[model samples]
Target: MGLYHNRPHVQDIRRMKARGEKISMLFVTTPDEAAAAAAAGIHMLSIEGRFFDATMREAAGDCFVQVGLPYGGWGSFNGRPLATAEDYLRAAFHYAGIGGDAYYCAASYDIQKTLADNHIPVVGHIGLIPSYISWTGWRAVGKAADEALALWRHTQKLEEIGVFAAELEVVPDRIAAFLAQNSSLVMLGMGAGPHADAQYLFTEDVCGYGLNHKPRHGKVYRNLGPELARLQEARIEAFRAFKADVDGGTYPAPEHVVPVKDEEYEAFLKAAQG
Candidate 1:
């Protein structure tokens, strides 16, 4: 609610959840998107550490920004994945130093706890973890009762580890609602339905410019793909025009070329000849 007044401290977010408020969250990759989210008074933002800098933090304005620490080799730093708990801890502190309100960690509970122990707020991932998609295979999780119970237990475990939040992705709405109502951890919903603490979506999905297949819950607010295609064509046409001008010798016209004083030109010509 204090979107424009001040950056929501982590405690503020927790209090929002405690009050049963629905929070707006977006996963953004650029400063422009972060700025837009902030200006629009979005409650929270999820940004990868790679894209998170002082500029982004400033652009994010009052939104509580969650810096995602890479889960595995998928997102690498210096061509290497953050392999150890220490790596995640180090990355969390680094981002925290730059004003990251929280960090999303998909590592083991121990690693997540390590971050929490250091007083770093952490958001854990559950219910169709992308890092382990090879096993789960990119589908809705917790449709069955046993699976739903498992997810509930997972949320409890994360809570026990002191994680402030858990990203509930692609889980049944009923299951998500139960978790949200029962747990202390804030539920950041992706494909999970309406009852979670926050509704989270990637900006690419919202803009209809996502490179990958859109998820079922993803709602495209604008179609930017066609606009981007048009821009690409314009870019090609401009390049072609430039090339044609260069080949036809029409680019370097009188005004385009730098001119020398008559005496300076004459002196240069004589010097060259000599």
Candidate 2:
């Protein structure tokens, strides 16, 4: 593992919040994406545990990386599902050892607390957790007064559980602004507007290559989807041309084949005939 002492720690992120600095964060899966984010001087990166390792950490450079622990049944070890706090803790510790700066755990309070107690910086999720979308459906949260209050209470609960930050996703901008100003937890905003401590976006969304429906808050900075499609077409055409060359005996041209000495070929022919 490369030395990652220069990466931002939990206190550093909190200090950024205190200073009212707007942090840039991205959810990236590939090493190339991580390296690009690092090169661009992104403050934080959210990577899934499955995609995080020493290589990923190295690619992330000095950016604070939040390795996401897969929640509940989605998380596993040796074909067994992670169903308990210890299971989640093991996952978090594994990534932490790999140089992960923080962990994003949307698991139960017990799991979150376990990671935090072990000195693992934990980032919790609030306002439109996709995993629990069955209850709230796909929409902006904290619109109603009671719902907003519940969201505020949820943030407090996460803070009490020792979580250092929370993903404030798809909450009303006004509500999110109010909560960010009042809350101790650093808010990593997805759809939560300018008042957040950090603005988070998926790499695919920013690059405009995502296959899924784009969220209203996700801004496409570059439309690389068409370019990527063109590349795929080029790949197919190149393969087809190679196949056609082979079928038409145009591939094994004189220059493409190794030349043997005439005397050696004659000797081989004589031996074969004998």
Candidate 3:
């Protein structure tokens, strides 16, 4: 509970948006990243439930963290997605209990409302949802007037459903700016635009260690790929050296082992003969 008290509350985040503050956010998957984000004064963090725990909360320091609940039909956990609204509710509660300031729900609106109904601060997603990637493909959404209008309408609906925030992904800059200014819901942008309340990016992309093709909106602050490669080579070299020592009988030199007293060895030999 003491660890939880140090973080920014949901109200504090809303107040920041109302004041037109530009928040910096990052998607982090490890405790080390969370600690670093907190140390670097990042305002928000989006962390999945699988990677979140008490240690992670402590590592996050004062950064507001949004814990992602597993959504249905996108992928499976234990061979199935969260199968019901109750599953989503239970998951959200679990993270909230662990000091999450908000919950990220990409599930149905009904499930989102269910969480909100229970007083959970929930963040919804609109415009190029990754769960629906099969239908939309991996591309920018809301490029045209019709699509932009639809995105705007959907964002309004999310606000009506009691969502505290919405993630705008890969939409046109004009559309994103319009939604941020016009809607009550705080808009967190990832490849959307500069006018969003918060700008979000994955830590991997920022560090240039993402294994796949980088997204168009990704801005790399450091090239960590080569350094990671160097570390891997060093790991292999160290393993080879250890193997050579074992094969050459140099690993367990006399100083590395213990010896029995002469009297004890003689007594053991006498007992064996008996």
Candidate 4:
């Protein structure tokens, strides 16, 4: 839990984000995905609230796991959906029990501060925030001067409230660079360009199993789709073989069966006949 622990200090992540370093990684939704990401030397990860348990933590090894608390709209904030700051605090402590390195939320500033006050490293969302897409629509945000400027201000506000890092999603490189250079928060880029402190992508999108075509920014290192399909086929075949053996009475061979002694059988039959 000491030296080998994959989680870095909150201040450590802050320093790196402030420096505009390229923290390479993707989000994982399963133990197997986390294990694979850890094995690949990816330093950071985002795990959904559903996956926030001891099993996933053990599988993640030393990699950073940012537990995504379910707020609503997947990763968005609409209305008073999250309710109060206690919601964030409770979820933070709950997941932290299993060694979650950080917390990701799209809640309001008050809610974010509640988590931070309790010593939780909160990762806020910026640019193309899906939950608040009503204002910006479902497209790249911060492209225009005013939009970029607003995002810059948003970054500043997050830092002011004591957040450790922010996810800068789906903005252009130039705007992302400017925000990265100015803000104190760690900029986790999801197609928001190389200006971010870390590059973030979803494990599903990277594995070629995404519902939509792979985005231009996502670079697939492995194609597990076909591999997984092939494995499923093999499993089905193995089960079929066992079923066939059972139906044909070929499973319990002579060496596998025991027989009653001839003397015992003869005595039983003779007694019954008499």
- Report, for all candidates in order, the number of backbone clashes: 0, 0, 0, 2
TM-score of each: 0.90, 0.88, 0.90, 0.81
Candidate 3 CA-lDDT value: 0.89
lDDT of 3 by residue, 1-274 (tens): 4543767887888899999998999999999999999999999999987788999988999999998877776544445689788888778777777889898988878888888888999999989998889888999999989989999898988988899998889988988999999998889999998998899999999999999889988999999999999999999999999999999989988998999999999999999998
lDDT by residue (tens digit), candidate 2, 132-206: 988999999999999999999999899898999999999999999998999899999999988888999999999
TM-score-better candidate, 2 vs 4: 2
Off by over 4 Å in 4: 1-6, 18-20, 73-82, 236-274
The sequence of per-residue lDDT tens digits that candidate 1 reaches over residues 1-274 is 2234478888899899999888999999999999999888899999998899999998998899999998788797546799888888878878877888899999898999998999999999889999989988979999999989999899999999999999999999999999999999999999999998999999999999899998999999999989988999999999999999999999988999888999999999999999
After superposition, candidate 2 runs with Cα above 4 Å error:
2-4, 75-78, 243-274
**lDDT per residue as tens, model 4, 109-135:** 888888888888899999988778788
When 1 and 3 are scored with lDDT, the better candidate is: 1
Better of 3 and 4 by lDDT: 3
Worst 10 residues of 4 by lDDT: 73-82
